[model samples]
Target: MVASSLISTNFLFSSPLFPPRSPIRKLTIVSLHKIPTPSSSHVKPHKRSLLPCRPLCPPCLNKLLLTTRNPFSFALDSLLILCTSLALSLSLLVADVDSASAFVVTPQRKLQTDELATVRLFQENTPSVVYITNLAARQDAFTLDVFEVPQGSGSGFVWDKGGNIVTNYHVIRGASDLRVTLADQSTFDAKVVGFDQDKDVAVLHVDAPKDKLRPIPIGVSADLLVGQKVFAIGNPFGLDHTLTTGVISGLRREISSAATGRPIQDVIQTDAAINPGNSGGPLLDSAGSLIGINTAIYSPSGASSGVGFSIPVDTVNGIVDQLVKFGKVTRPILGIKFAPDQSVEQLGVSGVLVLDAPANGPAGKAGLLPTKRDSYGRLILGDIITSVNGKKVTNGSDLYRILDQCHVGDKVIVEVLRGDQKEKIPVVLEPKADES
Candidate 1:
């Protein structure tokens, strides 16, 4: 009799949601020996009975044993039976391990440290978040005001102890009456204190007590980096204060200013889900500091598309400072109309092409040439502004923005391209009037 080693493979498949299982194999060894025979039984020394047998190779033997029947078949069947049982046992063990490791199991029936930290931060800041609803009224045939109409809903935050709340101007655009609700389920009437449409920022005042006002801490946007963790709390589409998490996707991206038609450079881009009502909410850093004001999102379905834009805190800081101090933003301006410097180059010129200048304006009074119509009704070329106060003017917006940094009554040198000649002229900075 010979001993045989039995082996079997029970390979497992893989799934996309779970890790692949390990290949399993079991080996069974059967001990075989000659049975002891009594001496008296072999007294006659009977001629050795030679059973009809053929030398079978290991592979052939296995096949024959597995396929045949009788005493030998029973032994082979036992080997296979043992192998199957071992395989089943191993499978059960592996399954148990997989089930144990597949999902998280809370031991104390509570959140983990990281999760608790997140919940804590949300709990701490939730009270400071607010939901704002804007309503409008329509007149009836009798010229009497009828029922109020719901215009829109948006998010805001407690801005100061003076009951000043801040929100996006677009949120309350054309709104007659505004209402703000805090996280504690308290509502209050709100009024617009100051608004800068160009910056898409508006300050609202509520009659809430000092204890109810908890201004959010402001952070410096200049210190933010791409991929820095961020959080946003807002009333998305009238849904109460909801918190979304993501990272700063980008910075300094030029986006259309909601308040003004001019492009706002240095805007903050985030991946946080900023929906309709999130328009005026704060985009906060992990430290709970406001880095940006959630303004717009790129979504075709009016939902968050994973791409949202915000007004950087630096821009907000500038606008809010002016708004708080003067009730209006007196943005600096250069009294000149011109196109991009690249237009000059594309048009085969070497300077900023002046488009128009207001009569009695700073440029007109400074003797700066302005584009005019010719006798034949053809548009004649005008003075091309090249620089301001020795600073190169790249485009109309650039020149405009640069001039905005200047105070009214500030004197600066203006360079222009008169026809084909470059010359410098002295001009005084003028206050940009409200064009509304």
Candidate 2:
């Protein structure tokens, strides 16, 4: 009877009506009930109890018996265990999600002063920048139809609302036709207005609407200081209106012109990344004012090497004005030819050796003599120009530079060295003859 009662209790513990305790706890309770009773027939039943026990009533015994006979009791226990495990896993996932959401971070944003200024400058000046394309005419071999083919591309800036654009002369040189693309991507056919080959500056005009034109604000390059901030806006590598920032690396630098083979004086040297397609673009000051025109860079691989040169706007302003007025530079001349600098140096001469002076020219009229060969075939040296108006003329370039400062019909005193004697004679300047 006791063994049958223990079996009934085991089944009752596994039923769904009772709480689903662990199998170990259930086994512990069953072992307690099965504690051995003392083998004493004379002892009273209550006094001989091995352990304290709750009396099993008839209703409890009946329920335990019925649970033992049920066949689905084992399946019910397994279902309860699986549901509990699933609930525990879902609760852990929810906790992790909540923790992650509570500690989320967002980045803060701030604007720098220099960066803001650069942005403003680009916005204001980009409209004045333009892209120029050089085109050459090629005729089809079969149809004889001519079409303009792309030769090269570079950058330029609008000079005025009248559609006058300024760029490097080499940018448009040898092109049969030209096109200008504005910042808005609108293109127009450009006609050559004027060009100064010696300065490497060219002016072009397009029939663009006045409202579409934006002229770059002019700045004085003469007062520019080294280390001052500079900006460049150009179509670098055919990429339109690209902005590059740098400081003025040097001043009064000289670069040879690609168009005329003459030295460009007072060039502004910068570290701004000027490349091939940037040739005619404007170099601006920090205040968004046009300071110079990017012309060349010193590089062996035909790329920027951080040594870029710009034609100073101070020189550009005067040249452009003259070009627009006369379609050519009206340079003043002394009407005298000199021996080459190399030849003069070999002769150990310190001054420009006068090779010839036209009989009807200003120098000849002023009684300046030229070198000649005597009847005996011995070379005879004439007057050598030593200075002009007190400025020393060491070579032909110095003489030309001094004459450039004078205008036509201006009277200047010319000092020449004749043998061991120095003479100062006054001569009037004249316009240079057009070789074209």
Candidate 3:
């Protein structure tokens, strides 16, 4: 009974209201009898606590409360974090797109007036320009097969709707086959119709469709003034339809033909870029009309040197017309041979020295005397022609050039120096005899 009372007292001391002063404080209550164990073997035994039960500290109690949180609140927090990440990613993508759009630039859609005119000129005339290729036949040494090989290239333009094309004669000289490529890149075999070696002009015919042919507008070179703006269109170095522009640097210039040793008179000079492949191309005026034909460039490096020469269209017009009508030029001739220009210049003479005059010829019928060597081996000077129709005859070339302006039936006054007497003679022009 006393032990029971002591246990009840211990329970009361351990209660929440009446706690012990020290956490390690122990209660020593004496028991009168020992507790008996349970008799049933199947009954489980209760486990005794090793540590004394105590109330949790303030920090541990707060941690326990936080661990047992509401599951719904945790789920809401996770959703909020995911939403923030997606919003940041979307904002960054929007910024990148804005930066890219800011860097984009728009192109210009309009051109200046001069720029527009140049563009229009090229577009209008490019269709009329054509590319010419010269091919030569060569036999392969090993295969023993004859094949046409490309020898050179040049440029040309349409002359008429009949498929006639005009280019430099040197471009087609010695070529086994000729090929012409149109502006549309359509290539056709060309046949040589006629060529003037002295004028360096050639006429070719291609059986191309009439619709593909666009003739260049013709212009007169007679009135072309120096410093007038000009344009050149050609296949420069095989590059088709290239255009170069400059002013007319000079007029009435002369250059010798590569085909013939004769001089090509009345040539037009320009600063336009005329290269190798531009030999047969057309030089046009600001109106996009053909004014000249680009034939050569005065360059040592085989490139443009700001000194390019062209055959004036005025000369081309007459020569081409004659070539189309006749297979060759029918130049009026004075049937008398004269000494070389070098010989006359060395002798310090002012007129053409008549070397020979054939019997029954115009010069002979006009009683023009020829130089002779007497039996004493002394030189006898012949009739020296001083002028033709008031035009001074300085040399053989000058005399021939003047006669070229006259027709076969035309009459001209010829002034000659016979010994110490000056005489005027009348002579009728005649066709030149065919050269053997």
Using lDDT, give the best candidate's number.
2
lDDT, candidate 2, 1-436, per-residue tens = 3444454455555555455454322211232345445698887666533223346545445445544545575567656655654555566667767877878875655669998899999999999999999999999999999999999999999999989999999999999999999999999999998898888999999999999999999999989999999999899888857888899999988877897566688899999999779999999998999999999999877658659899999989998998777777776677888888898889887889988999878898899999999999999998899999999999877886787678888999999999989999999887766722
Candidate 3 residue 11 Cα shift, in angstroms, is 60
Please give the RMSD to the true structure for each candidate, in Å.
16.4, 10.1, 16.2
Better of 1 and 3 by lDDT: 3
Alpha-carbon local distance difference test for all models: 0.76, 0.84, 0.83
TM-score of each: 0.70, 0.72, 0.72
Model 2, residue 421: distance off in Å is 2.9
TM-score of 2: 0.72
Using TM-score as the measure, name the better of candidate 1 and candidate 2: 2
> What is candidate 1's lDDT per residue for 304-403, written digit by digit as tens?
6768998899889888877777888776555667765666778886556777778667787888877788889997888877688888876666676667
Q: Clashes in model 2: which pairs?
A: none
* Regions of candidate 3 where Cα sits further than 4 Å from its true position: 1-102, 137-147, 300-303, 371-380
Give candidate 3's TM-score.
0.72
